[model samples]
Target: MSVHRVYLPDLGHGDFEPGAVLEITGQEARHAVRVKRLMPGDVLEILNGQGLRAVAVLGESRKHPAGHGKTEWAVDVRIESVAQEPPISPRLHVLACAPKLTRVEDMVDQLSQVGAAAWFPLVTRHTLTPPKAERVDKLERVAAEAAKQCGRAWTMEIGSPVPLADALSRTHRAIRPSARLVIADPRGAPYSPDGSTDLALLIGPEAGFTDDEVDAACRAGAMLCSIGPHLMRVGTAAVVASGLILNAEQPR
Candidate 1:
């Protein structure tokens, strides 16, 4: 059986090689000691949430200073081995208007598990909810928790809301020549899976995209693609479209 996995946010991009020592503190520490009931000699997998994971054995537990005269548990771990995973292929990027706040975490969580490279809340003609920095920060935490459960070495990247024009411009500049841009539309071409290494998918809001918005996106090089005849909710369409694209990229 695989060991339980935990995410250590402060571990950063390096220093997780074999034989390294990691000190996990704060809420992560409390979860390990108090919730998981882990103690010295316990073994678990640790992830840096940036494509690196390690097998680590817990060392002695100690009390660490917390804010406002509070104290929290802390733990030390000896890293046994570390491996870095390459980013997922098809490199799926979903750009959409923000859904209801109640559904944001669920949307982020499932998308991370499905291996989306990033999620961008787009500001569009009919965008119901504008992006806020705090909400985007919360989505990051959601992605991290989802990654921990799915054993993903890397967490999904979340972006603050940007205008559709700016988002399209940035995407165009960043994507490679081989990458494909797709917009989800009911009257568009049927989604035929391809083996492209990178894909950028655009999904509109509940009210749908304005014709001008679609025209701008298409003019900027997005191919209109349809999920099916039936309309799907924003979050559902995002997950379903991603899965379809990824399934197409898989070896038959």
Candidate 2:
């Protein structure tokens, strides 16, 4: 059976050397013990979200009393080994106009699974429904869950909504300096990997970008590229464009 994985945001704060014992508490511990029925000696992996992963074997578990005779579960796992994975290359940062309703959640989930470094909602002239703070928080949770399911050591980041102009300007350079910017447009040139290690891909909304938006992007050194000939929804275009950029090889 595939070893179950759990997230530990503080994994780096503690020593994860072989033979060390670490306590996993709260929901994570409860899920492993109660839901998974993982007993002593069961194996699992713990990821720190920042590339540290530790293989561990389950140890003793205990329950701490909450008020009113309620109890919370905690599990101890002994570290077997630890490994750090390097970040994926040609890191793709997707900035797409939010799709209507809950479709944005599905977009975030798929982007996480496909190894997009991060995602930001693009606030464009044609954007109908921009994500709110609560939605952003929920998307972060979704990204965390996707990391565990996909066995990714690093979880994809969820960024706040960014306006098209700000996203294309040097003011945002600190976010991903030297990153090549690409805007997905139906009338653009064919997409190709340009040997850039970092990329920021912009996907427009259902109504599409204004003519001025596309023109400004071009003037700001952004390339207009098309993933396919057919029209795609905001979410679908984000995933398809991200996949093409991430999986393609750089010119030799």
- Ten-residue region with minimum lDDT total, candidate 1: 170-179
Residue 171, candidate 2: Cα error in Å is 1.2
Candidate 1 lDDT tens digits, 149-229: 899887899976667886567544434456788889997897877678888788899999999988888898887888977
- The model with the greatest lDDT is 2
Residue-level lDDT for 6 in candidate 2: 87
Worst 10 residues of 2 by lDDT: 168-177
Model 2 bad stretches (over 4 Å): 173-175, 249-252
In model 1, which regions exceed 4 Å deviation?
A: 65-69, 167-178
Local distance difference test, candidate 1: 0.82
What are the per-residue Cα lDDT tens digits for candidate 2 across 1-252? 778998998658357988999888899999999999998999999998999888999999999887798999988999999998888887888989888888999999999998899998888898876888988889999999999999998999988878888888856642476889999998889887768998999999999999999999999898899889799998899999888888884334
Model 2 score (lDDT): 0.88
